[model samples]
Target: MNEAIKGNILTPSGWLNGTISFGERIEDVAGSSSDPMLNSDDYILPGFIDLHVHGGAGKDVMEGGDAVHAIAAIHARHGTTSMLATTMTAPPEDIDVALAAIGKAVRQRGKGEARVLGAHLEGPYINSGKLGAQPNFARAATIEEVHRLEKLAPMRVITVAPEISGHLELVSDLAKHGVRVQIGHTLGSYEEGVAALDHGATGFTHLFNAMSGLHHREPGMVGAALAHAEFAELIPDLLHVHPGAIKGALRAIPRLYCVTDSTAATGMPDGEYMLGRHVVHKCMGGVRLPDGTLAGSTLTLDQALRNLVGLGLDLADASKRVSTHAADYLGLQDRGRLARGAYADLVVMDRDLKLKAVYIEGERCDLNDA
Candidate 1:
């Protein structure tokens, strides 16, 4: 069935006031020629594509099976049309389970759930020194292990520490197989980060969280990312980064995007939750380890949008941060814009940036269902 919705439709050029007709893809977007400043009412925009997400709704991606469905359902309700089923630094068996399950979900995504783009193996090849909230499952990257995992399921992205032994070669190999290599959880300096990018490390995971910090003489991963990395995912829940820093990143890296490093505790009440092999306590609107290092988060993408808006970004740029940049980063040509023939994955929000409705593949979602 064809469907049409009227509102201030956000397009790549700017805001358009009219109706969008769509089915599986956008059939047409008839915008009002007389463009007035968009009001603070029902605004239609592209659905968010989260490149990094762990789990939500009390289910971890490591749980596998229906856990992907649960996580997708939960995020779909919050306006994420698609996401990577991000994994943690776990043992080989655990990683295998997560990869298999994520591949299955990608092959057979159901209705009423966000599309699982693929698996983002966060790490087994990261630096143990900078493993923020990740367990002690750190190891060096090896071609044999990478091949075995690829055989199990398609690996869309993998995070590595450039300083890790034998990882530069692994980065080149992973890139050869069309996997996006992200640098993270490392104490690597600017030189090493540049080397990784030259070897095909195209992105940085949760920038400034687990990687080395910037200094005057020896700008580390953070500096390298801000200055040279092609893409970087940021946690903009306010808890992960300061507003000033977020703005700085936005100014520095035009391709910078937002990601919810959310955990199983998301959408649930304050309580204890598992992050890989460690236990994190959730309270006071934050998740943390027993030693007080910040864990993941309980943030949803809608709230992330609100945070950007609160930080004084206009709607279009905020939408780009959550949708366009991520989609482009993953090379998803079908989404992230309200253009004709794009996937009809969109979000509806009131003036206050609150989620009013969500549509994935042109099907309306029950926001209250998850």
Candidate 2:
């Protein structure tokens, strides 16, 4: 977006009326305004970035096709500009196919939806004890499997159980391939979790939902996320993790991030939805088991933001949980901030926090279907 579009700039202090100048490409941020302009009526924070999102608008990223394209558009409408196509815990072949699909979208440059930086390979490499919705048959990746992914050369982030056999070596291999490793779906102790971090595990995937609860003596996976100063992913639908737990997780983990971890059930009516042959029934704000074991959420990041604000969190702080912090987890320096040099990929919202517009690579994306 050239032609010197100016608006209210949201700084850490507060909203300031200023002109944000840009260069030829969306990646360039140059120029300054001595005299500020525009009103401070709403926010101008960085756009939302979701590192874990399965699918929405009745489309599954695993289903391939235009799933990434469609889900991206729908999510952008709710305030996500850059995101990862979260893969479910599936068979090795299924995972490979899903990841290849994500690679296609990245190559084609998906339209109107959130820009796909890479794929978040959520499973086939996790502890079965905490596999809430994931199929138990799939477990942590072997050294050979990790090496195969490296050979594929696809942009991939992985979640694994640190305590699982071979995962420590897998973590090192993945990190070598530039794959971001996260500790999730695990029964790992705090010590093991910390070890994974030392080995290259950068964050946690949906920290409390599938992982073991924290204990006074044991200090399980959640304990590791809380004690370590690394980023912890949370589904802030307020159902996946309790409101009280959210507060505590935030206090425990210095960089707690919000992710949808949503399924195809999201943006669809309450009914049976397929999450790779597992029948996920949408109930309330999430998908769950018949026994009420909470599956993935159906909540949007926009609602997550509202939940944070209603919980008395500052808007900027809440926005960063999805945008800035998640971006940091993915190691994406060019995104997560609305500053001049960052990609113009952004979401504009109204006072009610409803999404008004999305700019992807400087073009205004039409989110009518979302």
Which one wins on lDDT?
Answer: 1
Residues 278-351, model 2: lDDT tens digits: 77888666698677777787888888888998898977788788788888777777787766567776666666
Record all residue pairs in model 2 with backbone atoms less than 3 Å apart, i.e. clashing: 29-340, 72-113, 73-113, 125-140
| lDDT of model 2, residue 30 | 34
Error in Å for residue 19 of model 2: 2.9
The reply for model 2, stretches above 4 Å from the true place, is: 1-6, 11-14, 22-40, 150-153
lDDT of 1 at 293: 93
What's the lDDT for residue 270 in model 1?
94
Q: Write the per-residue lDDT of candidate 1 for residues 257-299, one digit (tens) a residue.
A: 9999989899988999888778888898799999999999998
lDDT of each: 0.90, 0.75
Residue 24, candidate 1: alpha-carbon lDDT: 86
Q: How many steric overlaps are in each model, in order?
A: 0, 4
